[model samples]
Target: MIKIADITNIEERKAIENIIRNYREDSGTVISLLQDIQGHYNYLPAYILQLLSRELKIPLSKIYSVATFYAQFSFNEKGKHIITVCDGTACHVKGGPLLYDYLINQLGIHGGETTPDKIFSIEIVRCLGCCAISPVMIVDDELYGNLNMQKISKILSKIRKEEMIQEGSK
Candidate 1:
């Protein structure tokens, strides 16, 4: 719920502004701008996207395509915790599907869907490059190996507790 103008990171904001200013009429540059925005916000804030469209004179549809086409781009506000399950060839053969189902059912959301309370979003990745930990899942960049449904619940509760503490502090 923060305004992009409220962003305190001057350099990051400048990079986005520069990209838009340099390529106001170029659709190609729109893709790059969206990428940069996503990198800054974890998810592209809707207001910023509108700002870019108006400033760049690009159609909103085009901007949406660029945002949705890339797996990295997320339109919805991402949760404080991002849970990514790896389902590459190695992980798939090693019970990845079950883990995926577990996450979906437990979180009450499908892959790419944020939780109702916005505490977590579950994402499925093709590979995490850790075959040794075939059924590996990452929660906020922290990798967990040899996961089971029980462990997922434990980790989620721990994360929710931590988020609550952080929210209280703010």
Candidate 2:
């Protein structure tokens, strides 16, 4: 476990301190502070949270409660790409489950799991407000609807090719 005192990244510590200072006066800014921290680190680092608790003089329990209560806040690191499958009533009736299974099988990851390479993370959401486009899967911000196995394969292939090209360029 990383302790607050052991946070050696001077710039990161400064950034956290700055965030705390910026929101210190506003008692209701806890959520916004946490959101900024999460945006910086992708997930809340335990050491940073400890630092925040000390700097802001807020109880760790309260901070933790707020973090866990919000579905958007995540403790675990996420993959570079987030794939959300809609499992709403409309989507489910239109073969959302099948698409989810196909994704799991193809990616070799269960729901709520990131691929080993960190290329993709699979998640299921209740709704995406696109009932007309039921059975939808969103990769990053791009949405795919009316999908079949072949369309899924093509999409995956295209993404993989793009990634490979990007990696090669890098």
Candidate 3:
């Protein structure tokens, strides 16, 4: 286990310390602590998890057992934008796989992976709960349904153009 002193980033150390202090060793608060960590950092970082294991006297395996049980938590760092493709029975019947293939080809990253540039990542989900809008794709919070490759391309292009403009300004 890496010691607290081994963490090089001053801010990260402080954040972990704050988490430990806030949660203490309360057994029931483990999930809450993990949630707090994920909420603050966007994901459970490996170093932070290790520190948590030692301080809480919980085996790393136990911690992982709990974390993996929930889909809400992610171990990998995510991109700025999350693209969710629905592959549920309804969506699948309506060409969801075709949409997914287009996304992997266009974004150059498989589902559950971020693009090399960290601008986009794809997440494949069983359903988004709106069966009426079958074959759905969601970009961040915006929902698009009844999509074809053409519409998907236009949407992706618009987002890329917006990003390029933002990058130029910076």
Candidate 4:
């Protein structure tokens, strides 16, 4: 077994330890603890979940269920850029599927798969509630609307360039 001494981040370790201590006896608090961990790390790592489960004596299945059920929680390692395509009725009627396919084909990965370089993760959402902007996509929270095939290509190119620039700066 790996020793806790390997955990170097004192604050982070304390935060997690505190959560576990405060909610040790509360089974329902597992979800909240997971959320707090997610706030620290963009996505929940399986090992961390297992650690919490062991500490709290919660079943792994129950932890997995909550993670899968919540839309806010992500099991996949997220990319620097998150691409969300809206496919609600309004968006769907306006060729959302076509746009989604274009993105997947171009990225060479389906929704939830991060690129090999971990620069992007494609996501499909039922709606953004912006029916007016049917066939829309959001890149890192910036919404683009009224998309056509050509427009999508351009937008993707722009995203790639932006990612490249960010990487170069770092």
Candidate 5:
């Protein structure tokens, strides 16, 4: 329901124009252009995609296909904090499922869901490339290994407190 004019400011429109101009009808540059757009906005806003389609003279469906095909691209807005739980073979063997379940219970959101307040989002990834520290979960860039329910509780509490303090400061 968001309009292009509502979601895009003058500065963002100029940036998008620059990105399209730089690549200009080079279909090979589609991925790179989308990446740049995603960098500007946390996710690919529908309006931006529509604008990109018109600017590049590419089919909107084609652009959408590319966006949806990639796991790295997100269509919906992400939360302020992203929490990823490793569900790879090594992590699962090391009780990754248990950790995931614990998080779901604590946050009241399953993997791939964001909290109602938009404070946190959880994802279950195959691996975080740190199997050495199996059963690992990451909050934003910080990693926690050898996790248990107790550890998860403490981590969530700490993050909540930090969010509260940040809100108070604002």
Candidate 6:
């Protein structure tokens, strides 16, 4: 039997083991277990999912079926930083689509596409629940509301510069 360490790093393997330990008694918690895994890894890695399938005695087909049913779950790897642009009705009225277009042009990436350097990812969501803060851009956990293209440019530029500094130091 292939061990989890054969597919993932020691830290990742440990995380998977811990997650399994939490759900081992209840086989019905597959969704919860997968959700926890996604939280740690950002996206659902194929190998990790296969490892999960074997660990839980669940068929790969069934695991994939559940994973496919949820749009929030992703199989592709995500960038270190996530940039979400809201395009809901309120945000749209406030130029959400225009902002999204600007970002797509500036970053050379659209929804679901990460930058080549894996520094940033751009995503479009229907709503962000803050109508007053319409036309919002979220970078990781920080939110910037009522954003103009200029503000967006500055924000991204600052992040890029910071990343460059860190890379140089490394």
**Candidate 6 local lDDT, residue 114:** 90
lDDT of 5: 0.83
Residue 102, candidate 4: alpha-carbon lDDT: 83
For residues 100-142, what per-residue lDDT tens digits would candidate 3 score against the true structure?
Answer: 8888899999889998787898998888998897889899999
Score each candidate by Cα lDDT: 0.81, 0.83, 0.87, 0.82, 0.83, 0.85
TM-score each candidate.
0.68, 0.79, 0.78, 0.71, 0.76, 0.80
Number of the top-ranking candidate, with lDDT as the measure:
3
Candidate 1 lDDT tens digits, 36-109 = 67766778978778777776668889999878888778778888789888979988888889978878888899
Order of the predicted models by lDDT, top scorer first: 3, 6, 5, 2, 4, 1
RMSD of each: 5.3, 2.9, 2.9, 3.8, 3.4, 2.8
Q: Write the per-residue lDDT of candidate 6 for residues 65-150, one digit (tens) a residue.
A: 99999888888878878998888899998888788888999989999899888888888888888879878979999999989999
- Candidate 6's error at 156, in angstroms? 1.6
Ranking by TM-score: 6, 2, 3, 5, 4, 1
- Answer with 5 or 6, whichever has the higher lDDT: 6
Q: What is the lDDT of residue 135 in candidate 1?
A: 83
lDDT per residue as tens, model 5, 67-129: 888988998877778999898999999988878888898889988888998888998888889
Winner on lDDT between 2 and 3 is 3
TM-score of 6: 0.80
